[model samples]
Target: MLRYEMQGGIWVYPGKGGWHFITLPTDVAARIKAAMAGLARPWGSLGVTAVIGKTKWTTSLFPDKTTGSLLLPVKASVRQSERLKAGDAPIVTIEIAL
Candidate 1:
């Protein structure tokens, strides 16, 4: 089996749409557009805009090697309360499996 660190939360996006969680990576971004695109619900296509994150990014790892997890809900997803919050975006996060 493959081992993963969970690292932190991730944000799956669909262009102008809100961000969702396809399947957060461990210590890397989706690797490529196809990474998440392939696993998307329908499969064979992810016709959004772009995804720029992985594993709960933060200022600590910006520019060079950021945390790399772009998981966020552009609009309503933020107002879900407790689960999410609206503000200046999120970055820098860590998580591990149980």
Candidate 2:
């Protein structure tokens, strides 16, 4: 397993019913790709366990081709529970099982 801890701002996808996400740091993204790219699911997503504040959930890290990074989706429930919103910088922990 591999674990990463990072701080990033939440942003909403620019579209109707915009989805929220936090983009992993470039350094972290590079490391994750080097270690787990082969294990990624379809569309270059990897299963991961994510934690923020006191909330934890099973989710996936999705590839962001333009940025060459991974984006972690922050679901509505988790966001509300964590008191997070767009533009808020939050520390996030992600664990990937090999």
Candidate 3:
């Protein structure tokens, strides 16, 4: 398992499919990529456990081709529970099981 803490701002994609996501820092993304090399699941995603504030959930990080990094989707429930909003920088703890 790989564990790390990071701070990222929530961003919303434009248009009708607006979705909130947090982009992992390049360094962290690189580390995760290297650690998960040859072990990536379908669609270049990695299963992860994420904790923000007191709320924790299981999800997957997907590679963002446009940004060349990994993006973690924050569910509506999580955003509401964590009191997070777009442009808010929240500290998150993530664990990836290898």
Candidate 4:
């Protein structure tokens, strides 16, 4: 298993859905990709454990074409519990099995 701890600003995807996401830094994303080189799941997504503030949950990291990085969706419950909103920079910890 590999763990990555990073800080990023939350952003809402535009359009009808408007889901909130935290983008991993390019370097961190690259490192994760390398770590999971032979074990990536479908659509380049990886199952992970995400931690934000006092909230933690299981989610998947999806690859973003535009940024060439991975994005972790922020659930509403986590947002509420962590007092986070779109555009707020929060520290996140993610764990994944290699």
Clashes of each: 15, 0, 0, 0
Full candidate order by TM-score, most accurate first = 2, 4, 3, 1
Looking at candidate 2, the ten consecutive residues that score lowest on lDDT are: 32-41
Tell me how far the alpha carbon of residue 19 in candidate 2 is from the true structure, in angstroms, after superposition.
0.3
RMSD of candidate 4 to true structure, Å: 1.1
lDDT of each: 0.32, 0.92, 0.91, 0.91
- The best candidate by lDDT is 2
lDDT of 3 by residue, 1-98 (tens): 77989999999978677799999998999998888888778999988899999999999999999988999999999999989999999999989877
Candidate 1, lDDT over the whole model: 0.32
TM-score versus the correct structure, for each prediction: 0.23, 0.95, 0.93, 0.93
lDDT tens readout by residue for model 2, 1-98: 78899999999999888899999998999998888857889998988999999999999989998898999999999999999999999999998888
The pairs that clash in candidate 4 are: none
Residues 2-72, candidate 1: write the lDDT tens digits.
12233334444446654444233423545433244433433223223322233232111111123344332
**Deviation (Å) of 22 in candidate 3:** 0.3
Best by TM-score: 2
